[model samples]
Target: MSQVIGTVLSALGRLGMIGAIMAAFGVGLAGTIYLSLRSPEVEVPDIVSKDRFDGEATLRDSGLNVRIRASRYKADAKPGTILDQSPRAGEVVKVGQTIAVVLSREPKEGEAPAGRDEDADDAANAESSRGGSSDTNKNDNQNRNQRSKNVNRNTVNKNANKNTANQNAGNRNANTNRIANRNANVANRNNNQNTNNRNAVRNIANVNRRAPTPATTPANPAGNRP
Candidate 1:
């Protein structure tokens, strides 16, 4: 009986020692896990405008993880370039914290180029200026044509009026000449009629003087002799 009790007690004692050792090991493991969970804080670096691969490498070197929040088209930035970051540079964060970043991509088809709006406006203004000048020249040509037409019309009218006045003067002179010729014809007819009447009166007077003297002397002598 005494030997059996000794064996049982020794076995019990060994079991208690093993339990204690196991408990100690468990506590040490728990402490190590808690310490590891509490990581050191670090400052965020400036990775904007860097290449995506280079930025990721930089973040890894700083004991940080990267998260691509979005991608967008950029005219000036190269494709796969890092354009922005959250929890910006110099901000303190825990190690292994994730950084959100925006990456650049090529512009889609039909997208306009950046910084060219002013050039387009300048071109449009130049075209408008040329159009205005062309319109002005057209208007000037029209005015010149109208003025020339007016001058030609006035010249034609002046020539017509001068011809009419000359025709009227010619008609008046012709009428005056006709009246003078008619008066001269009337005067010549009157002079010829007066000369014919005087010649007839002298012939009658000569015949009577030559025939009456003989007849009157014979009558007076016969009256005295009978």
Candidate 2:
């Protein structure tokens, strides 16, 4: 029993030593990873100005976020050129720390120039509208004139037809009068001829009446006795 108890105690001591070594190794590995993640940097060389460095990309590459606090202008540096930074360029900031940037616009000109362009576009549209209205009015006048001319032409045609009809009726009346005159003359001439025929017949009958009547005897034997 004493031998078995001693063997168990030795095994427990070996297990505790192994756990301690594993814990130490884990702590050392965590420290090495933290140091490796904090990449070293050189003072930005003079050739590459701090202003031109892409702080946004640099921050994101280091697993950091970007936040903007405030912005200011400096004439010596280009408008967009970073005049100053929150965490100076090479500071060892935590992975989640943010970097902010400032953008630039034309200093002298603002939205007024855009407004002027809009006004110019509006003026152009107004002029075009006026021109369109003028064209529409001209077309309307021309159409009205054409309609008037058509109406005149139709009226003229109607008048001409009326005059032609009147002339035809007059000609028909004249022809009827001429035919009536011809028929009256022919009737008078036929009546005169009939009268002359009746007179001649009467004269012939009178002459026959004035002529002597022959006396009839009984017979040839009777003529010797007379």
Candidate 3:
């Protein structure tokens, strides 16, 4: 009976030792599993519909690095709101991981789009060319008008000079004609006075000669009679 009791005590001691060893092994395995499962990563949060500053802040709070990818125009979407994101929301990523995003903005009224900058530059160049052309045309017109005015003035001055010369020439001709007529009248008066004096002298001489002849004839007749 003593031997059986000793044997039974020995078996109980062995079972207790086994149980303790199993429990220790189980605890070690559980600790390893928990450690292996743990990671230093967080979920990427959704920042859509948030303002640009607010979205970046939220991304930073969610253990992410924020970067702007691009901007887009969405007519129905909110202006200056987060539009899209890389590494979509709820995706597990390492802490301080960069998240690229696209920002959204509505097109303004009468505002040109970003894609139209080159076209706008071309339009501006064309408009400048047109303006330059218009200015050139205006300058040409002004020059022509000024030249026309000058020509007209010159023509008027020439006509005036011509008229003055003709009038002077007519006056000179009239003066010459008057001088010639006065000289002719003076010559004619002198000739008439010389002719009248000659005729009077001849008549007196003839009358005196006739008187002498008659007196001589009467003397001769008286002598003969005596």
Ranking by lDDT: 1, 3, 2
* Top model number, TM-score: 3
Residue 211 of model 1, lDDT score? 77
Q: In order, what lDDT does every prediction score?
A: 0.81, 0.62, 0.78
Quick one: how many clashes does candidate 2 have? 0
Q: Any idea how many clashes model 1 has?
A: 0
Candidate 2 clashing pairs, residues 3+ apart or interchain: none
Better of 1 and 2 by TM-score: 2
- Residues 79-186 of candidate 2: C-alpha lDDT, one tens digit per residue: 445433444455455556555434332355333222445434443443353344456788999999999999999999999999999999999999999999999999
| lDDT tens digits by residue: candidate 1, 1-226 | 9999999999999999999999999999999788668878999999989999999999999999998876767688899998777667887888988888778888888875444564344334433533444566889999999999999999999999999999999989888888878887787777777777777887888778777554554457556665
Clashing residue pairs, backbone N/CA/C < 3 A, model 1: none
Residue pairs with clashing backbones, model 3:
none
lDDT string, candidate 3, 63-118, tens digits: 78888766766655677888666666887877777887767767768755545564
Model 1 residue 203 CA deviation (Å) reads: 4.5
Q: Estimate each model's TM-score.
A: 0.36, 0.38, 0.38
All models, RMSD in angstroms: 39.2, 31.2, 38.9
Clash count for each candidate, listed in order shown: 0, 0, 0
Off by over 4 Å in 3: 1-131, 213-226
